[model samples]
Target chain A: MFLIDPILNVCERLGRRLLMLFSIVGRLVMFAFHALRDVLVPPYYPKLIGQQFINIGYYSLTVVGLTALFSGMVLALQSYTGFARFNAESAIANVVVLSITRELAPVLAGLMVAGRIGASIAAEIGTMRVTEQIDAMTTLSVNPFQYLIAPRVLAGTLMLPVLVFIADIIGVFGGFIVGVYVLDFNPYTYIQQTWDFVQAMDVISGLVKAAVFGFIVTLMGCYCGYNSGRGAQGVGAATTNAVVSASILILIFNYILTQVFFS
Target chain B: MKNFKIEMQGVKKSFGSKDVLRNVNLDVKKGESLVIIGGSGTGKSVTIKTILGLIKPDAGKILVDGQDVTNLGGNDRDEYLKKFGMLFQGGALFDSMTIWENVAFGLTQGQKMSKKEAYPIAIEKLEAVGLKESIAQHYPAELSGGMQKRVSLARAIARNPEIIFFDEPTTGLDPIMADVINDLIRKCVSELGATAVSITHDMASVRKIADSVAMIYEGEIIWHGPIEKLDNSGNEYVDQFINGRAEGPVKF
Candidate 1:
């Protein structure tokens, strides 16, 4: 009877935790619905969307570009070491181009954006929530879901693909520079090989992943921030949760997208 | 049967297991300024928030002008909200926007007025709040707390709202600044002829801004009457609160 009582207590605790998790997910899904719905309604803010585009896309160019370039360079160097042993050194360009266009560009760029933009969105909105700016907005006849969340979510979704496409180009260029200057490969041959092996579908699939990751990043940020609890500690927790959740969702979606495209 | 601008009947709200408002019933006459006074966590803010429909009551009816607005949504909610302006305790000015832009936010965004049309009005409201037109270019973060609070007040009064809510308007201000704010609030409410609902623990603010006073204690209105009756209110809670006595019916 004592053993049974302990087991029942453990089951009750687990069940309560599970219920809490489901409730959080449900609330997040509802928040996303309202955010997306507000996007299609009247009183759209094109200016706000454009401002977010500059913030999420243009400003993020440096970090994402730098990360992609170095990653491509490293991939080429690593490929050479392994392929040279099998006399397959000629395949380094193919591997770098394929990996960058199909996977690395979108995934790495998404994580970087999740770190930068997600944290900022969460902190900004969380501060607004605590200070009652959100309530003030409500009293002033402004729909916060429309005025705040819609523009950010739309900008994130649209701008990420553009960034990833640029990342793809810059990454391939990085591989080209390494192949021609350091690896002693013929520049023209390397270019020709990359051009031939890369398919349109590869870039398209990567861009799709970028869009999904962007949506997840901004959505999680808005959710965490909008539902943030009362004080400084709440805002801090929201920022952390936004980054962590966005990064995890990015990785998970990247795998699902890869499977859909390749498998 | 009285002429009421706003009324909360049996209003109740709870966060998790703790009930913030167990059964709050109160009303304000048209064009009257009512100040709610209470100790912190006694549900003064929650009471007004429930009235404004910002915090939904768990079980109650909130009526504005005798219309039950408890379940209003979509365009109905937006139209209902257009009648109100609120001054938050922390100013809540948008840090990203300039002072004029912050003042003009509801005008531009809610009323669909163009920025150019709203600009002069924003400056005018700022001036009305005793701010110079040159201060319009600066952001909220650059302003002193008092100046920011003034800007918030300007924004609140900019649209000529029919109702205004001030949450802890005098909090965190020095006596002089708080006195200045209290005076401005009185002037603004009188000039606009709007119904005003304010929540504060500051006795000075209450004396200055309130036509009537309601004292909330433990989620209930323990005492309510004319400002002249405040000192003589027989309720012990009101006596202790107004006197700032540590030992009383209200323990900390």
Candidate 2:
């Protein structure tokens, strides 16, 4: 009886898919609540947390540090060329420090960890799930969330800020090297400029962003992996989905945080 | 009323739109070995799992020792689960753990026994299962299929639980290995005097292990009797499944 019957049916399909999307989000939120709630509770596994801290923070230092350093160098080099046109080349130090601390360091480190650690968490958990190790834990009277997930989430949230702080320092140092060596800037003047221009708020905001990013990385990994489908192909899909979703969420949260702080 | 170790009255469950278990009733006496036999997906495993509290039934009640476990959670659930042990279909041994650690998992993790104390007990259980103590340090991946099944069996009975559940205990094993596992199962159940419930399709396993047999079809126990009366059960569904007949009420 309706003229839009065909269109309405197509709309129903789209609506169903959208409903599924929200359902997944709802599931993720509930998962996060359980994971975060247990983070500070007793029966805490210091042994497992200590292991995850080392794995997430200590092992990741080299790659994150290198990325920060190289990005800083490139930023300094490019800004010098850009500012030289207007004879504002003196602003190179300020720009490099601001960009690295406010956005670049946290973002690059987050993306890198998302690729490396997210895929690892997802793959490990997915394999455990398919092989029935998670079920085995349940049967053994162990809470899988407390034993498997809480430690990693707590470590990721607590450690990433520290990693990003290190990245901020190494990044500024990298800028210093390039500005002093390749750009023929005065080392003394460059230091003075960086020190003078950098604000505490800039660094603090970046560290906050890093902490949130770290939570996203580990959480997506565990969620995707825990709910992974059956078999090797299923594990592979979970790994890919974890990395892709974590990276996307990082970018979205970055913009939102920037709007809150800067706009 | 006889004191049954475990009992389920009208227990029912479904997965989404698919009703896997429908109006199932079962009972096991203390120290009795009851094997539930059926074709795959006929609710045999689901029936046992429902009793284990792994899957909550959508309807009816599940009782253990005359206590209702329908709404158990938190400490109550943990205490309930501590009374039982289960061997999964694929052994479900933690690959990350060594053989002894896998056997002693319940003692150390659930009961909080010191590892030093649990390790000796673990070695003893492994020895009972005919596995050498030398393999105690080896990983599950290093073991063969039959060895893994034995290790899983060892783990199941390790805690000396009051009740034990074996899901397809002899599946995925060669004939000789299946017979060996059957003997071990019989020995474990007899020595511990535990209430044992097993779900299996292997007829040979049923004859060797079951003191009483219940045959499930379409989520219902269509026929149940002692093992000696099984061949003459006269129930077509039970007859068809036991004979493995291609032409029967069970659809391919």
Candidate 3:
């Protein structure tokens, strides 16, 4: 009983520390919401918006699509092998479409994009902030918030859904190719079964998750960049923090949104 | 003898408990070139940053043309900013932009000039700074350090600002290139009839460019007078800094 008491106390302390970390994250999220509020109020920079869209969105498509496609193919193969025991190999299409659309596409896309775009944004802006270029912009009649933050946040929110939609289609196609050619399922039957199980809710839920994850990724990037301390080491720290925090937030938000949409 | 264009009276700034600028007072006449000489980390950059309103002062009155500009905001701040130009220590050119585009950035973005209008003006400024028309399409990274400094100087004067700030404009250049840059700075400032405030540790630049010199020590102006008086300023900090002595009041 005495040993058990000490173990329970340590668990309580760990739980408390986790809650404190969560609260800090929540405050940062609230600060991001305010920054977004400032963003929409305008004196907009369309040039910066277009640039970031190309940078964060267009540049990210190949990686996200490739990840989704390979993940879908592997998932179909695994499911086929597992269901073969019961002679339920026909369930491969249902499993591939459902898993890719509901979970894998959005999560993988979000994480991959987070690593690529989030780190770059943080590092670029973090270097600028530390080098006093951000301050120079302010003194040159440009608002750093309006010029820097608005376009990035806007691009992340608007572009991720489109990327995720493309990822979804490509991923499902990957599964189709694997299921039909490799596993010898009839093409028509595979497509039909895929359509039968995937309702509009699944696709919509994934897109919603993408949009939320995009916001988390970009907000974390910009926040870390903006608050980066003075020097190369500071910028590096901000870049790493942005990727890690954005990835974690994406996963956590994925679970919460999943519960809301599914449960 | 001319009217003062910008004035900082008892400006004080602190980051937490560490006071950076302490009771800094300065005045720049309408068309005079004022050089501030200080050792590294003596708040030379911080003083200029405060006047630019990049770092808000904890206490001070900064006046431009008799208006208290310390607390200006929004369009007012932007309007005030248009009157000034700055040449940053690193040139700070936008990496994504061409040389001409970087030169014309303020004219296009802040002034809302058409690219067609801004392009010719950018070319003219580039040429004025001894850069050829062929180099206009090249990016900042393609330029040599001296060329980059010339490009930055061109950008600084692109708007024909009433006031210009130069922060360490000749730091990394060879002696001949530094002199050329100093000469360009003088010619540009005089041609534009702009009041220039320069902060540098380079005494050569100070001698070449300054109408009046101010020596900053421990975050305050310890000595200020005409450049002719710099050789006989008699202050220990000024003497030590200008001579580049290792044994001085300003210990590294």
Q: Give all TM-scores, in the order shown.
A: 0.97, 0.96, 0.90
Off by over 4 Å in 2: A1-3
lDDT of 2 at A127: 94
Please give, for residues B1-252, the per-residue lDDT of candidate 1 as tens digits: 779999889998999999999889898999999999999999988887877778888998999989999888888998998888889889999888899989999999888899999999999899888999999999999999999999999999999988999999999999999999999999899899999999999998999999999998888888889999999999888999999999988987
DockQ of 2: 0.67
- On DockQ, the stronger of 1 and 3 is 1
The Cα error of candidate 1 at residue B14, in Å, is: 0.3
Summarize candidate 2's per-residue lDDT along B1-252 as a digit string, tens digits: 787998889988999899998888887888899999988888887887788776889999988989999878766887788888888899989998899999998888877789999999999999999999999999999999999999999998888888999899899999999999999999998999899999999999999999999988889988878888999998988888899899988786
Poorest 10 consecutive residues of model 1 chain A by lDDT?
A132-141
Clashing pairs in 1: none
**Tens digit of per-residue lDDT, candidate 3, span A33-101:** 777876788677888899999988899999998999999899989998899999999889888888888
lDDT of 2 at B119: 94
Residue-level lDDT tens digits of model 1 in A159-196? 99999999999999999999999999999999999999
Question: Which candidate wins on TM-score?
Answer: 1
TM-score of predicted structure 2: 0.96
Cα lDDT tens digits, model 3, B1-252, are 438898999999988788889999988888999999988888999998888888789998999888899988778898999999999998888777899988998888777789999999999999888999999999989999999999989988999999999999999999999999999999999999999999998889999999999988888999999999998989887888888898978788
Quote the positional error of residue B102 for candidate 2 in Å. Answer: 1.4
| TM-score of predicted chain A against the true chain A, for each candidate | 0.98, 0.98, 0.90
**Looking at candidate 1, what is the lDDT of residue A115?**
96
Ranking by DockQ: 1, 2, 3
Q: Give the per-residue lDDT digits (tens) of candidate 2, residues A1-263.
A: 58699889999999999999999999999999999977866557788899999999999999999999999999999998899999999999899999999999999999999998999999999999997788777777777788889999999988999999999999999999999999988999999999999999999999999999999999999999999999999999999999999999999999999999988
